[model samples]
Target: MKLLKEMIHPELATRTGRILRRHAARGIVLREQDQILLLFTERYNDFSLPGGGIGEDEDMELALVRELEEETGARDIQVKAHWGYIEEYRPYWKPDYDLMHMTSHFFVCDIAPELAEVRMESYEVANGMRPVWVSIKAALDHNLQVMSRQEETMGLSIQRETFILEKISREIIF
Candidate 1:
């Protein structure tokens, strides 16, 4: 896929540079034992997959690994599939940019099955954030307030989820 600069709105190109200092980024959804791992975010008090902004000139997969480790204290990630992309929108509350949005590359991943040690970033999740393992069925609901907040930041409206479902559906089934 083309970089966001090549494909996005012209306005995004002009203002994004000055407004947002951070560059492209990626994230991951790690699954184990029919459940998915998620982190509660401090910024919005939302439940989201572990992720973060990509640094300058960083590769997408490398960014994914970095984010997963920083947010979830996870290591040795084994990616399963590319779950597609999300055009993340930074609402007015965000202070890091002149632009009001970002784009993210997302993937589905897996780690060790049993409960292994986790190292949560205390600063990132002092109270509003914590690692939670939820069943796939429960996680798919995406109805709670935290999830809604997560949806907003992650650009996870209905259409995005639908696309992700379509991408992963075949692999999930026989």
Candidate 2:
């Protein structure tokens, strides 16, 4: 896939002495007419695409399929196109690491007519995360609103999600 964007967090611009943990994640764009598949996290009061971390050595396609299933209960997923990837450098906040470099790959996909049950992780559950079919504009607007407030409830991935939502709205959904 091609590189879409590289976002270096403003806070990390002057920081140093940090260990790097490179993470690879995948997300999908599953659209039905005017609606798109998204994960709404009540805790963050924001929306994001349905996907998550890719395990070590996992195939990108496999990870996309697995993440769609795990996060949105999406079935019959067909990754139609490689949308591209976004790279982010942000605070890691772990004992051994102070920065994280993440590469998030995105795809344009098609899924079954009906969704099954979401198998969200424990943290997702605690955050009140649920699958929702919403317009790309809605997701983008809502995330931009949350980011403007810069609240404590905001999640780490919100910026990336908002950026992707904007890109999708412009490049695909519009």
Candidate 3:
């Protein structure tokens, strides 16, 4: 997998601690007209790509399809291309899990109009994850605002998504 981007928070780079490794699969769902499918988390007040952590020994493509359907009720997904991957290093993210090293695989996908009812996980419902479609530019702008905020209340996942969206906006949108 190509390294699309690597981000180490200023604080994390200076911290001396053990880091946990995690891998996730993410997707970029693009409609023919440039609309992007996104997951909006009301709890976090942020938007992210429709995908999640790859299960133990799970195939990356299968995990991406499963996550997209689970989160967005999407169907007839055709992964057009591999959108590369990103890595993030975060410290002080959690008390028990002091450090986190996450690598995310992203895919460019197309979904059919007919979709099954969304089957969200318990935690997803609890966190207010909902599917929404917006223009690529709008998504990028929203994420840019989130990234520019002084208070870092957004999750690292959202931050990573923001970076990915910026790249997509440059390469795909504009």
Candidate 4:
């Protein structure tokens, strides 16, 4: 996996803490028409790519497929390309978790029209995660809005997604 970008929270270096690393899988679902599939979460008032963490001993491609299906009801997806990966570091994102490091692997995928119902996780449902198809410009604009806010108040996950969206807009979307 190539490193597309590295993001470190402003305060991360200021704090003394133990760093923990986690791996996540994310996808940029682009239909033939060029619309992007994103997950809108009302809880955080943000849009994110339709994928999640890689399970232990799971293949990266398979993990992406499973996450897309679970989050967006996507089926028969064909991964077109690997968009590389990104790393993000945030200190004090959680009380129990002092320093958090995450590496996200991204893919460019195409989805089949015949889709099943979305099967979101309980927490996702509670957070109002819903699949939405929008133009790449719209997704980039929305993420920019989220990124423009104060980092102290913004959700860490949202901040990370904002970075990914911006990168996708620049590298993948025309």
Candidate 5:
């Protein structure tokens, strides 16, 4: 999230001007044996990556680890590489409020294949955040819906599903 505060829109003075502080978030594009980790969020019942907003002044790397643990209970993750960033301009949802811009930091992580036997948090489980492994290509081909247009842009644009698929092709034994 620290990386996001550095990005600015041409029109607005800054996120500070709107009284909305910057939020940093991290998502690990977990891959194993040619399969990408995905979650079927109960809220909208859609498949998406695992991540959440970073608290004020929170360390993004720490936040990423915490979010991954909270959402999927996967430990001992090895961050393989950084996939860079994506920016979106809108509140996560609830269109009535002032729009927010989010900068998402994405990383490619390696997780134990056995962690697929997940322990979903009750909060998230109640809301439908279930772990699923899908082929990199399959995840891209599905009718994926991010929380919002901005969120979709923030997630999908970082690696673009095509690029991720290519990388997955060489790394995992599909």
Candidate 6:
């Protein structure tokens, strides 16, 4: 995978400590026109890609497929391309590490016409995470709105999601 972008938290720029690393695989499931699959997190008033952290010793593509199924109830998922990756260095929320580094791999994928009930985790359910096929611009605009307001409900993933949404808007072919 190629490095699409790298972002470093301002707080981590001059600070140093034990940095824990994590990896995630995200998918871009595009339909005809502007529709794209995404997770609409109501609690945060934001949207994110349908994917999650890669398990230890798991293949990235497999992780993407599994996550898509779990998060979006996607069927017949097929990863067609290694889109790119984004790297993020931020302050860790855990006590064990002072900072964290994460790489988010992205892939373009295809899914069957039908979907089933999502099997999201409890936290995701509590957070009102639901799978939806939304206009790429709608998700992006909504995320940008929440970000601009600096809402406390906004999650850290919103920024990354917004970035990818913008990229998709620009690069997605008609």
- The runs of at least 3 residues in candidate 4 whose Cα sits more than 4 Å from the true structure, single-residue gaps closed, are 14-16, 32-34, 92-96, 149-153
- What is the full ranking by TM-score, best candidate first? 6, 2, 3, 4, 5, 1
Error of 2 at 162 (Å): 0.9
- Residues 33-101, candidate 5, lDDT per residue (tens digit)? 556676665465355667677888787777777777766666777666656665655333344445466
**Model 3 whole-model lDDT (C-alpha atoms):** 0.83
Over 4 Å off, model 2: 14-18
- The prediction achieving the highest TM-score against the true structure is 6
Superposed by TM-score, candidate 5 places the C-alpha of residue 170 at a distance from the truth, in angstroms, of: 11
Cα TM-score per model: 0.60, 0.92, 0.89, 0.87, 0.63, 0.95
- What's model 5's TM-score? 0.63
Off by over 4 Å in 5: 1-22, 91-96, 116-123, 144-174
In candidate 2, the residue pairs with backbone N, CA or C atoms under 3 Å apart (3 or more residues apart, or in different chains) clash, namely: none
Question: lDDT (0-100) at residue 97 of candidate 5?
Answer: 42
Model 5 residue 47 distance off true place after TM-score fit, in angstroms = 1.5
Highest-scoring model, lDDT? 6
lDDT of 1 by residue, 84-144 (tens): 5555433233555555455656666866554445555666645556667765445445535
For each candidate, what is the lDDT?
A: 0.53, 0.82, 0.83, 0.80, 0.56, 0.90
Question: Local error of candidate 1 at 102, Å?
Answer: 0.9
Better of 2 and 4 by TM-score: 2
Report the lDDT tens digits of candidate 3 across residue range 55-140. Answer: 88999999999999999999998888887998888775567767888889999898997667999999999999999988877877
Please report the TM-score between candidate 6 and the true structure: 0.95
Q: Show the lowest summed lDDT stretch of 10 residues, model 5.
A: 1-10
Q: Give, for candidate 2, the lowest lDDT window spanning 10 residues.
A: 21-30
Q: Residue 100 in candidate 1 has what lDDT?
A: 47
For candidate 6, write residues 93-173 as lDDT tens digits: 889998888899999999998888889999999999999999998888899999899999877778788999999899875
Residue 24: error of model 3 in Å? 0.8
How displaced is residue 58 in candidate 1, in Å? 1.8
- Kindly report which residue pairs in candidate 6 clash with one another: none
